[model samples]
Target: MSLPRIAIDAMGGDEGVRVMVEGAALARRRHDQFQFLLVGDETQIKSALESHPNMRGASEILHCEDVVGGDEQPSKALRRAKTTSMGLAVNAVKQGKAGAAVSAGNTGALMAMSKIALRTMPGIDRPALAAVMPTLEDEDVIMLDLGANTEADARNLVQFAIMGAAYSRILLGRKPRVRLLNIGTEENKGFDRLRDAAADLQAAKGLDMQFDGYVESDKINRGEVDVVVTDGFSGNIALKAIEGTARFVTDLLRSAFTSSLRSKIGFLVSRPATELLKHHLDPNNHNGAVFLGLNGVVVKSHGSANAAGVANAVEVAARLLEDDITNRIAKDLAELGEARLRETNGGAASEGTGK
Candidate 1:
């Protein structure tokens, strides 16, 4: 049997090579059938490896002279930093040297580089990032497009729906209920693009997905939508706001716990529940985002993510690889295009006639 290989960006994040090496090592221990290739400055990577004897024989390093910083413009970096560590890791996926790529580098640069190297699949207008969000229910929800494409049309939203649905099915082991993110439940609401996308989604065929119509932001965690679709701009804002709110609430609770003797006693009594909540809200458990609609899997981890977080990202990549999500997504997207075209042309003659 062949082992799966993941390319790691050794020079990314604040923790750098130590976390990258540790993450790869941790993942390898669980599944000895997995291997990794760390891409970065060869000397720095080797020096990092020398500090850990356990990983000496487990991984290989690929030399790359440059590294793209987090603040660098993605478009400019794509042209100038072709040999950077992040670029090399993603390029390996395009070249078929690895099954998947995992990077904790600049999100914009990674997204741009992945698209440039791997290209989007046929019929996918623009790729988007879909991250797993913990829901009030026992499981997780998949949401997109986390700032990959800020401006989207009706067609783009429909494409996101198709891609997100396929991802839910492939990763979650069942078809998900799809919902368009909107301010209201009525079909007449939302921007013109969202309204049109709702219709397109409603009439869409061959997706084998359940469309539950428009769901408001409040319903995201209410088990009303398993897959929420929206433009990248709104989606990104929602993601950060939710994360920030979660942190704020946690901090408030910590302050309360340390306030007084009574509060400390109360905290001790609620410690178990608080700990469980922390586990559920930990970003490390769900650190990876898959750039859907691409030819291959490109998993992005938070740039400040630790070894555990990177390990979680690696697990996501491995699971997607095992699930063969891209093939199913492509099939669904192709069907959506055919359905949208038929609806448009079929309605063309009836418009403005009031018939």
Candidate 2:
């Protein structure tokens, strides 16, 4: 099959058209088969593309006169869906002109526009944002609901698990060990909804995942579980906390290394090891946060991300398109439906037989 073409919001991100276009060019180098639909002002996009000679023939520019501001409310942004650069890029996905859409624009605006344009997939109540995080283990871990829905019911939590597990399968190439994030690891711990979700996941029959009970926030990066599922409220807070902690440790190390002459020499001696650590913890390496459960793939790049980070986000979109993530999600939902049907039928039969 031919590689899918990705739609990019050229006017999005802090660096404007330059970084987005340069990122596209970088991504093209990694995946030569992929093409790009650059959506933004024609003159600016043309100027940006001029800097990357090789990207000239690989991209098609879609002129967009308007743009959604980073601070614009989702309600107001939705009204500009037909004209904004972000909106046009997402619309390309809805119209099937592009396989996926990537934007570094306003997060709220992007989410609102994507849902309105592409709609949620069947059996998914609400879409969730899933991102890969570097872990102590050899492989990165996938976490979900990073600010999509503020609150999730038991059913929503269950759906998040299924979607997360499917994503893990794509990234890890195996059935992921899924776990519900909570205050404690004990089954009896956490709120009613979390415990209830855990029970349902444990009783689930057909999913190709191992339910590993509850996992605390402290153990998330240990790589014990492949997928960590949680409501958006908690997930968003946890994500920010982890990011802050990573920054803190890195900053502390820098301070320690520059404290004195001896430390400076020590830093030079350990430069190789520190470089590896920096690479591992770099946010650019894990820049993409996918909105799973949407009918079409939509990757949200960090607003302040540089060309390398944007390229990483684009690569994520390409992977999802190639792997057909939506189809995999549908298949898993079917399994869950069948399992529920069987349970219902069995329960009715037992009641009728007075067992």
Candidate 3:
């Protein structure tokens, strides 16, 4: 079956046209049924496509010379929604010209444009930024609200959990193991926001997820948790910390290996193991950061991502489109709505009895 065409902001990333077109070409090669609406400078896109004949045949160029800058403010970029490459790509999704949009542009700008263009899905108060992180297990872990909203109350956290669970189901193919990111796993450990969200999830029945209480930051990439939910403030901090630590380890290993001839020989002996570690930790391998809870799919690729990373982001958009992530989240929200209604009614009855 043919998949829906994905709109790519071909001029949004660091290397712009070249990397973007190459990435789309690589993705199309991987998923032969994939197609794209490549939005960018007409000349640059056409030139880049010459080397990737496969993409040339599968994509239609949407000429756009205006581009959202890496440092431009979201407010500033929002005004040019109709002319900018990133804005036009997102508009394609809103206009039904594309099933999803992918970009490596300014994230704040992308999020702002997408929210205004697509709006939040029904029952979602605010959309969350969700991304996968490398884990010890064969599968990766999904974490959300990385930097969307600085603060989220219990209601928002519950919504995030629901959205994250639906995303996990799509990506991981199982009833996800959900957890709140907290300082401690104990019930009384976190602030009211975390504890209250946990209570609601526990009290509500029939949620398609296993509410696994809480997980500490240390355990985020330990391969035990499936979905980690938290406010953007905390989530962003944890994400940066994890990224920094990974880099530190990689740099340390490189220096150690090159420090001496003995270490160099040892590195050669352990090259395979090190290569596996390098692959596992490469950000490009887990490149897509999805704006969940949107009416349509909008994936954010790392600005520095190379062709492989961009390809991963494109594939992510394709998967979400094929699986109908919005509908999946809608169904999960409906179930949660039923559960919340039951909880409210049960509470009302208890209050009336004065027991």
lDDT of each: 0.85, 0.94, 0.95
Off by over 4 Å in 1: 1-3, 50-56, 337-355
- Clashes (N, CA, C under 3 Å) per candidate: 0, 0, 0
Residue-level lDDT tens digits of model 1 in 178-236: 99888999878889999888887778865769998898887787766789999999999
lDDT: which candidate is best?
Answer: 3
- Candidate 2 C-alpha lDDT tens digits along 235-346: 9999999999999999999999999999999999999999998999999999999999999999999999999999999999999999999999999999988888888899
Stretches off by above 4 angstroms in model 2 are 350-355
Regions of candidate 3 where Cα sits further than 4 Å from its true position: 348-355
RMSD of model 2, in Å? 1.1
TM-score for all models, in order of appearance: 0.93, 0.98, 0.98
Worst 10 residues of 1 by lDDT: 51-60
**RMSD of candidate 1 to true structure, Å:** 2.9
Residue 54's C-alpha lDDT in candidate 2?
78
lDDT per residue (tens digit) for residues 113-226 in model 3: 999999999899999999999999988999999999999999999999999999899887889999999999999999998899999999867988999999999999999999
